[model samples]
Target: MAELAHIIPASTNGPRATEGADLTESERADPTNILVLCPTCHTMIDKGYSQYPAGELRRWKERSRRARAVAFGTPQFTSRAEARAAVEPLLGANRTVFQLYGPLDDVFDDTRADQWGRHVVDTVIPNNRTLLQLLQSNRDLLTDGEKATVDIFAIHMKQLEERHLEGNWTPGSMRFPDAMNVILKGDG
Candidate 1:
């Protein structure tokens, strides 16, 4: 009787320079941990010579999804200084900007960045989620004025992202305080 064969990465038949070829010990055949690969494409795929992995594109797609969830959330801080530090680094060369860093060092999606910034400003920061936790946990270390300033800064950052998403890309237009003032004065 012929046993059913399963697909996997196997020892290279022809003479290629693999250091740990068939001399390796056998792994306990755990169905859960086995990775399947095509023998002909093994060298090409393993050496990063091809754009696509031959059989499984789903794993690559899954990695991106999980990475986005980690990158697109509001940052938490242990102190007001820490909170400011996180945002301060984001304050770019005259333009307010934030970077989303993920597992693979992927760049932030602009639309997702817009949503994340707004979420932090409108819901998280204003509600004293990140800042208050920082303050209370640090023995009420943040002065009222510092908290107020951060609140204002957070709101400003939110407005900037909102304007950016809405296509108001003129200089100083994406600025948080300036944009808010314009709205208050009915200019934009």
Candidate 2:
């Protein structure tokens, strides 16, 4: 179901061949140097149609390895609680964003509104971006149920950024509290 292509090409005449030269043939063939992609994606990459270059491909492969480790690595959890506890830190990063969300006032002038604008712009949005990366980069760590939760949160964060966080958002028009309640409270 997966196509394993060399991160550094097996052919010595290829672009990254020198880099792989130091590696033994077996090392060059090692799973670490390989990328598992769908057949169509594999063809695109192999045919040099992908936008990603060698370095980017390598980084993606490394992240995949890390994700796989998260899914299957040592210090195995003995219970659902233990597994949830392990990923709590990743999910908790959004706590400040949730706290700041409710204080946003779209139709009133108040200190909370001021705080909301500053906090959402200066902190929440940036934190959400990082949280997205954390969730995506370590996706394999979560169970199917947990992955669903994380994915929904990510979608909400992206939507919030696009809707209210980007650019000079009008003060009386951005009702983040109502708009992002689903994300903030995980109610949906």
Q: Choose the strongest candidate by TM-score.
A: 2
Model 2 bad stretches (over 4 Å): 1-93, 104-109, 167-188
Model 2 over residues 70-173: C-alpha lDDT tens digits? 67653333344444444445345455555755453355657667776676667677766765555455555556665666666676666667655566343434
RMSD (Cα, Å) of candidate 1? 17.0
Score each candidate by Cα lDDT: 0.40, 0.60
TM-score: model 1 vs. ground truth: 0.25
Model 2 steric clash pairs: none
Candidate 1 off by > 4 Å: 1-88, 92-141, 168-188
Model 1 C-alpha lDDT per residue in residues 84-188, reported as the tens digit of each score: 444332333123212331112375577766665565455433443443333333434345554454456565545555553465545543233432111111111
For candidate 2, give the lDDT of residue 61.
78
Pairs of colliding residues, candidate 1: none
